[model samples]
Target: MVSKQAGVDYTETFSPVVKMTTIRTLISIVVKQGWKIYQLDVNNAFLHGDLHEEVYMDAPQGLAVASSRLVCKLKKSLYGLKQASRQWYDKLTEALHSRGFEHSVEDYSLFYKKSANSSVYVAVYVDDIVLTGTNLVEINNLKSFLHDTFKIKDLGQLHYFLGFELLYREDGVLISQRKFTTELLKEFECLSYTAVTAPLECNLKLQAAEGPLTDPTHYRKLVGKLNFLTHTRMDIAYSVQHLSQFMQDPREPHLKATIHVLRYLKNDPILGIFISNVPDFNLRAYCDSDWAACPDTRKSVSGYIVMLGDSPISWKSKKQATVSLSSAEAEYRSIRMVVGELIWLRRILIEFNVPCDTLTHVYCDSQAAVHIARNPVFHERTKHIEVDCHFVRNSLQDGSITLPCFHY
Candidate 1:
């Protein structure tokens, strides 16, 4: 008799997931410049890769097996095999490389190709691919090539991708997850609750080990789903991140906090980040921190927002890995994190051949943190953050970044 199991943690074998920031940034550029964006789905994407190992599976119930003795050997990667994604990735990357696309060092899942006057970009997330470029004929040509090889389903335009719904207008594109959020609220029976103004109460503080234990399964499920919503709903990111920290030993209070987030979504499920068509797509960032916010370990929470022109493209809210002794220290750490994001995004734009003549602007509410970044006077208080200190100072000296004394 043949032996087989359904699945294993495929993540252990392959890690090809694209960063959400890359997706958001790409879409932002597409809409901002009024360029073509298309979606492609590879039909039975995993089946195209040939299997490496000799895996035997039991004959199907309807199969005419002779004496139940014939076990089928896998010739190609199947849908549920642990190595299916990896095999498919290797096959696809080889195909892309043969066609002259260079794999991006900043993001492995992103590939780009450029000619004297034309450029094309491809972002892959498993079986789904989003493509954009300056040349329409080249885009269609590439589509035909991929379709001929992989038998892809060419989903037109980019109205809906992954879990995001794109609503296009004359001035901008609105990205939302109203359908997904509605289903989530209904699934958890939170749709009937009255809407709230905010995802979290200002006084709310989540601790890892406090509060009575609840259904661990339900808490983990709710928290995981909420984390997905954060991709388009940045307002709920801080609260969702807070709830996620307690997934291991979730308490009733954590569940309540998640419910609060659902309630906030109910307030305006259709609302999302707007990518405007404004031509001046300059980059700017805002960073802040809450010193010693966590009651359990007194670790601070760091949050930042990165904007392309006026619309937000990337953001993060999470507890800092280390505890800071002062508010200025916490803010300094937050600055370093956001600055790193800025540098990466700038590099990506450069790769895409986008122009950037003006210096990137960064703003922080803490005057003390800003003062420390602009000057090199290292006293006892500043010695610990010397690495971050020099990081920002060098950028400043190079004229790539600036901390405007009074931000415009």
Candidate 2:
């Protein structure tokens, strides 16, 4: 055990993460079909792989050895090795490939195998694996195979994985972080605060604090967790994204606003996105932007929500990378990002063996932006745009995407 005393650079061992949106999309489809879901945890996952590099440690100065300069070479990866996770992934991928599972080209962690009668889907998050399939026989065989090959603790059903509390129903699954949120509220000593209807004031704009905080670490940590909570809590997405900007030098007002978010959570700790049982596979997207909302940097905020049927699977509210001279440019930039996500989402659906939605609609509130996208001319104002937003326009022309007239 003492051979693992030294820590390795986690960054070097970092593996690709399957997007949460992908997970949500998969869940929406699977739950709609009433498929069984199971989870598995690999014990000492990182230690199962062999080390390729010659990792060596110098002998202790006082220790007697044949040669003072002799070094010890590592044959297997330890828990903290720089290559541990990557090596483990390699070994796992090899094993899965041998078992007729194909690693997805779009999302590497997603492994699947489809036959005439059965299909199995596996979503991997580090050592934790969530399994779902149409055939229980195949799933059990794979589970037993994995257990014999690697020490796996099978956690029955997808009840709780990665802090998400899952309550399955005949209709669909209700996923929330009630326990996590409650503990977070108490951790921040805000369990007694009054709840509010909204997390942030409607017309108010937040900026960096006037002066340095007493201890900025607490403020940073609190905001970080709040941001993670946005994983399942879309109601607080905009507010958390707004407050995340001031993590470097947070002030009292920022802390107060963050506490406002926690209090909002206190309003409904069980508040989360509900995956519905609706069988509709139509893809619907709405993207909007607030131009020059940031008082400090004068950057706009771009927001979009993608729905599988009526339930949201992906949403984001983030500040624009570049300052848009006009509101139209900001909205147009948001269009670019959302369309890219649409393309990626469609590819993921195909990988899941789900049929593509024939008519995908991307709605934008800015009429001027829609007009500009439809008429892609090198206008003097749009000349400054780095990437042309002609993709959505082409989708419209090709009869794939329809820009419905916006009302209200």
Candidate 3:
């Protein structure tokens, strides 16, 4: 369909949506504050966007037209148009701005409106929206307004949205993709496969050209779905990350390891992160790296998890861009990556009126890396990673974060 459109019809196709991190962060806060969650769906969402560019389309197949040569001039955006999403987002922004809602600079898709007794947060994923706040009446009124403005359909209470299933409990809210996982398992014929205790084998190393090549299409499709599952299932994050490296030219060993992850999912598809109701907003992070983990490129893998109190809101397992000469350098670079996330998360929390005056604790496994980050002294060992050292040290110096060594 994109091939059918001309260059003048659309220029920008990139549309920002609410981030998964922001969604998790807000859900954690909602559970902590014991606020209500609501869901809204916009009917024919793309059709509401007003078009600014001059465009013409062929008339409908059954329409009674005066001539076959006549084309219809477009005034509103329609589905399949490249610019529909951007136009609709602009229209939604205007409508919300008129109602005192201010879009968050931290996250454009997130809009917040505050009054004397209430603060309402609305997260937009295109047409689907997740609304939450302390005031029930104000939330209902906003719902009414959105319906009147966009012909919205109220789904009521947020049990499911974006393939994630929410389970409210006495302790906290449980978010999972059990239904999605089940379908994934069944579709891949892994439902009846033997389950594994772990997603990947200990000390597992996959080579790009170790074995005969397999179907790249099948391997890529399975890996893509597994990547989406990692949103709720952090346990598979590392395995998915490792498996994705062989997508372009997958081999037999790569497919086997991928199937191992599928069996791990079959072991317990219901396993998910639990956002607790603890009244703590402190940010704590743990970062570590596997030196020379990749046998092919000898690139170390960086893994980190960020916790807001006991709830894990953000995490990642990625391969480093460059080879590190030492384990300490790899660890130092790992900490540097998390510091960026910590600062950005602090900004988001501050916007939510949460006090983040205390320094965040960043625990690392390598004492040498911690020493390198804390000490300003430079040596041959720290020369290559001076840029990373400066970043971590600056964050440490400003009281934004503290580097603490964790004993194994």
Candidate 4:
């Protein structure tokens, strides 16, 4: 248990996270090489680091300091300290670098060593580490090294991490978070609640202004937990994004909507994204938008989903920052945003030795948006749009993306 702080103990406590693209890329490489991925846990990970900051703590009830007025000075980082994560990261990097492992330029948390015949890669997400390599000997050697320095547990083969349940198959690794969903349901006391097929009703619209919440703290906590669950549940992405807008002044209706989501999860607890064994390396994306979807601000809702071959890897649903004049403009903006994600995914794939073509396919449901992307002639209709919105046109001209008119 953390002691109560008299004042603000931390100014900014955000930790750097490895992007989903990096994780997917690493998994894809592991699949291609038919390599085994192992999981390791650094016991009391934060305590293993030496603290640089002068942090003090009050003594526990039973334990007393020998010095009458002396306080406990921290020699190592504690869980709630502001600089704990950063200090741990710095220490781990120095140790890994000294052992001849080089970090990836695109992803700092990824360190690797490669030779003409063999390669080994390690991806660190806080304390949990996923080790992948070409040979089992090298993997075991590295595991022994980490164990000697820190208290490490070798979880035979990678089965779970960060709420993801991994199933290793002869074809490829299947990733899901069904176990995590079950735990979430039991925690919220919604394990036996009636479920709904869809996360939200087709016509149901959420707004910022709603009724008063009975308990704002409880509502906010539910929203935060659901947000983390989105790591493997893409179906809840839109619903969670809509519900998150009410954190400031959540009303009873808002809480009900959030609870409705929980009920839906109770029914289809096993549903999640499935990564398959398809060998196709083609990059494809779909972008869609609902014009003036938010009733409060009249702003549009833009969403996109990107896939590599047969697996859906990335998706997002967000409220547009600006009010779009028409559905075509909103769709165009959505397509532009998805293209950026696709390009980055392509780069990360290339880093993993996956072969990708020069141009990626981006599908849009709006014909007008397709016309805008394919045509260079900008008329008065599109002149009001910011210049950055024309990135789709630039991508088309440079043969980086193929914007095709598609239905749904």
Return the clash pairs for model 1, or none: none
Which residue runs does candidate 2 get wrong by more than 4 Å? 1-11, 57-72
Q: Over 4 Å off in model 1, which ranges?
A: 1-12, 64-70, 386-389, 406-408
lDDT, candidates in the order shown: 0.85, 0.84, 0.89, 0.80
Choose 2 or 3, whichever is better by TM-score: 3
By summed lDDT, the worst window of 10 consecutive residues in model 1 runs over 3-12
lDDT comparison, 1 vs 4, better candidate: 1
Instruction: Report residue 4 deviation for candidate 2 (angstroms).
Output: 12
**Shift of residue 203 alpha carbon in model 2, Å:** 2.5
Residues 234-264 of candidate 1 have per-residue lDDT tens digits of: 9888888778888778887888888888999
Q: TM-score of every model? A: 0.93, 0.92, 0.96, 0.91
**Index of the highest-TM-score prediction:** 3
Worst 10 residues of 3 by lDDT: 1-10
Clashes of 1: 0
**1-408: candidate 4 lDDT, tens digit per residue:** 345443454343444557765776677666655777888998888777776555777776788569756678778878877667877777777778877788877677888887777778888888888898886787788888898888798997888888888877777777777887888888888877888887887788876666766779999998999998887788899899999988888888888888889988887777777666767677888889989988998888889988777777788999899999999999888988898787778776765667786578898889998898888787977988888888878888888789765764
Which should have the higher lDDT, number 2 or number 3? 3
Ranking by TM-score: 3, 1, 2, 4
- lDDT accuracy of residue 84 in candidate 2: 82
